[model samples]
Each structure stands twice: as structure tokens, then as C-alpha cells.
Target: MTSAPVTQPLPPQVFPPTLREVMLRPRWIALLAFSLVVAGVLAWLGQWQLGRAVDTSPPEPGLTEVVQPLDQVVQPGDYLPEPLVGQRVEVSGTWVASDFIVVSSRFNDDVEGYWVTGQLRVAGAAAPTSIAVAAGWTSSLDAANAAADELERQVSADPTAVVQVTGRLISDEGPSVPPSGADPLTITRMSPPMLLGRWHDTAELNVYRQYIASQTAIGPLDDISSPAPDERSRVNWLNIFYAAEWAIFAGFALYLWYRLARDAWEKEVEDLEDEQAEALAESSTSSSATGAAESRG
Candidate 1:
């Protein structure tokens, strides 16, 4: 006679759920969504900071050629700020013929040349202020001398006549020593201080620290070209560092979620394993007791 096969009792179910099941739960899903939102906001903020770090303002249009009235921009006897060094300005003044001088070592488009410089006495001045002006450039001393002569002739015709001059404002080049035994009129640099002593009628004359390179020339002289302003962008390393940190934080947020899920899954697996082991031990003890009772009978 065949007896029915005995059935072992099943192990008890674990209380906590696996990682996959926990992730599927509504609470975990909401938490995951919230974490993503927070991470995304942080990442965006980091990117904004990075943009600010690398961003720079564009150079002002026509920085060298934008013509502004001289009186509006600055006053005589004041220092020209670095920002306004190459700006074009217009003023009304009369030429000082005797103050006209010649400067060597001047260059125009890679060609070594000379500059014909002179002072422009401001019109209607009670205190007698003046600004040095480089009237024109030439390759030959004769041409410079001729230009200077022509300018002097015009001033000589009417010294009190107000002449409107347009030119670029520049800082003083500072004084330079003329070569020993050189002509008293021969100058090495375009310095107002050097020219101040040579200028005529200086009992009450106030000289500007800056000078002007005139666009208008006297009789067939080439205009002195103004150089373009320098515009360079500088990078901010701190902002770049912050961007990287934000990206790491975003990844960490996701990792934290994964780690929690994995821990929950491991705990559930351990509980299941322990339940199975206990069930097996109980079944073995029951079998042993039944065999011993049969033996006694």
C-alpha cells in the first residue's frame, strides 16, 4: 500500500519588502520625483553661475572714434583717465605759432616719420590755458617744417581767431631728454612739460597734462591714426568649481536613493533566509520525535 507523501510546512513570509517592490511603492516614487526636482534646480543654478563667470561686456562701439565735445569730457589742467586716453574730442582754440616744435622717432603704418606738434591756446580764456596738439606726421624734416610754417602763417594771420579742432585725447608721453647739443627745437617725445617751457607767452598759461593728436592737418600732412582699444576677457575659476560641485551633488542625490533601496532589499532577503532555516530545523525535530515514538511502541 502506498502512503500519501508528507508535505513540509512553508516558511513564514518576511515583513519588509524587496528593493524592487519598495521602489514601485507610491511613497518612494514621490520621494524620487522630489529628489530629481531638487537636483535639477541645483544644476541649473550652477550653470547660471558658470555663465556669469565666463561672461564679459562687449567693448564700447567706436571706442576710439566716438567724438565727444572736449569740455564735456574733461577740463584743461586735469589728468586724462586711462579709459579716455584714445577717445576723440573737439575743442575751439587758436594755434600758438611760436610753440610749434618737431618730434622725431614717430612711426606711421610701420614707416619711421616725424610729428609736427604745437600748442592750441583755448579761445576766450582769461587765465590763458593751452593743450598740446600733434598737428600732422611726415617722413621728411622739410615736410614737417613746411607744415609747421604753414600752421604758423595761419595763426599769424589771426592769433585771436577761434579754430575748431577735432582729435584724439591721449595721456602725456612724459618728458624725455633731448640729445646733447641737439637743436633746442628738436624734441624726443610728445610731452607737454617739455613743450611748456618753449611755448610763448607763458606768464599765466596753464598747460594740460594730456595732449591731442589732431585729425585736421595743415597743408597736405597725413593724419595720425588712433589705435584700437584693448578688449580681453578674463575667466573666473571659482564659478567653474561651483558648477562641478553642483553636478556631483546631483549624482549623489540619485545615488542616495539607490543605496536606500538596496539596503531595504538586502534586509528582506536576510529575513527570508532566516525563516527558511528555522522551518527546516523544526521539520527535522518533528521527524526525529515520530521515529523515536514508533521505536518504543
Candidate 2:
């Protein structure tokens, strides 16, 4: 019987290329792009944080020396200029004790408690404005009441004391409501709605525009002054941290793309080499068979 005709085995076929394969075939290019984008974003966030850190102004000096009447210096519709943000100002007023409201979540140096807010009637102004002087906090309602009573007694006993109150002028924190069963007097802090509920006529006062004028003491008592506006402007670094994390993820995505593309390219090259080798082997065998047939003829 004639020997079966010799034939070379066929090489495995290659799959069609994809868009992703062409785009990220080069690992270095992908890596470079990824690093640049990540660095740019991180640098931007870092600069923003640095700007925030430097944007703040130092606390104004000579607050006591530049004391002026609160009503004269500011009006209901007027904005307190940046220069006066934390300045100590003097107002001659009689305490309107009956209008006191308990603000929740007030704290002293050591204890968490409530703020006893009251209206201060300027010596000559027809309308009284609200002011919040942080009274000492107590853990219980009874203690808060005791503190309120003490403040009331002090105001009543010394109505004509011509109290020159000095404190940092802070914008009113609008009211809020606490969960049911939460006591405003004993709770550490509460929202604006809860305080408004206790008011006979919430509309009487411009609650939205009112501010907390910290009372250092019943008299011009000494304490640390309020913080400067610039100090409050420091950019939150956590935002930068979040940006950095995003950049890292972007870099990782780029890395994954590059790795997959490189692996696919190497596989394609190997397949092509194998096919070429098989084609050459088949051609060589065909030529040798033709030569032997010609000699027989």
C-alpha cells in the first residue's frame, strides 16, 4: 500500500483584535498617561487645601479698645463687615428676662448643656433684639432651671447695673427640632424649630438674621476671645484625601488596561510565529515530494 501523503499540522487560528487592544497596546504610554492624570488631580487638591490653610485672617486685635455700640455699628439688614467678625463690641442694654429661650446643645469649657437665650433691649431702641449668652451647662433639667433662675435674679436685682457686655458677635444658628421626648433644657444641642415652638410669636424677632453674642460674664468678665475669621477658613484636608484616593483608583484602572493589552499582544505574536513556522514546513515537504516524483518519471 502507498504511504499516506505527508502533511504538516495546521497552526491554531488567532481571534480578531478589539478596540481596547489597539488603544492600550503600549504599557509605557498607558502608565505615563495614568500617572500624569493622577498627579494633576492630587496636585490640584493639595493646592486647594493649601489655599484654604492660608486664606484665613488672624484675629483682629484691640477689640476692647475699639468697642462701639452694637446697634450703631450694625443694623438688622446690614452685614457685619469682615473686620468686625470677631471684634469685641459693647452694648448698653437691660436684660429682657421674660423672653428667655433654652437652646439645646450648649457647652461650657467642661460640661455639655443648654444655652439660655434672651432678648436684650438696647437702652434707647424701641425694639429688643435676641442674644445668646452661653450659661453654664447642667446634665439635668433641674440644674438648667436653677441656672436660669440665678440669671433672672441677677438681672432683676441689678436692672440698672448698666451692664457693658463684651463678647464675639456670632450669627444666630437657626433653630432645629430634636426627636420626640427630647428636653430642650437638658439636651446638649437642638435645632431652630424647637426654640421657635417655645416662642409666643416667632415672627416678632428676625430669627433668621439674629446672632449669638457670647456673654463673657454678667459684667465685662475676662475670657478668651472668639476665633478669627481666617482661622475658620482652613480648607478641610479630608477633601484632598478623598481626591487622592480617586487618583489612586484611576491609576489602578490604567494599570489593568495596560497589563491586559500587553498580554494579548504577546499572545498574538506567539500565534503568528507558530503559523509562519508551520506554513514553511508544509512548503518544504511539498517541494521534496515533487523532486522525488520527477526522478521516478
Candidate models: Cα lDDT each: 0.79, 0.55
Most lDDT-accurate candidate = 1
RMSD per model, one decimal? 11.7, 7.7
1-297 per-residue lDDT for model 2 (tens digits)? 444444544545565465465555566566657766776676666556545544366444454346666775567645666556655566656665554555555555655555555555556556644444443334555555666677777777776655556665655455444667865443334333344445444456643243444546342222323444443433556665666665666566667756766676677777777777787788778767866776666
Q: What is the per-residue lDDT of model 1 for residues 1-297, given as tens digits with 9 covering 90 to 100?
A: 534444555556556565778788887788789889878988898888788777476446666678898776778788776557778898888887677788887898889888988888887666888988888899998988887888788778888877788888888888887788987667888888888878888886787888888877755589876675565345668888998888888888888887886777787788778887888788878877766666666
Top model number, TM-score: 1
Point out where model 1 deviates above 4 Å.
1-59, 124-126, 232-297
- On a 0 to 1 TM-score scale, where does candidate 1 land against the true structure? 0.56
Find the 10 residues in a row with the least total lDDT in model 1.
1-10
Q: After superposition, how far is residue 52 of candidate 1 from its true place, in Å?
A: 16
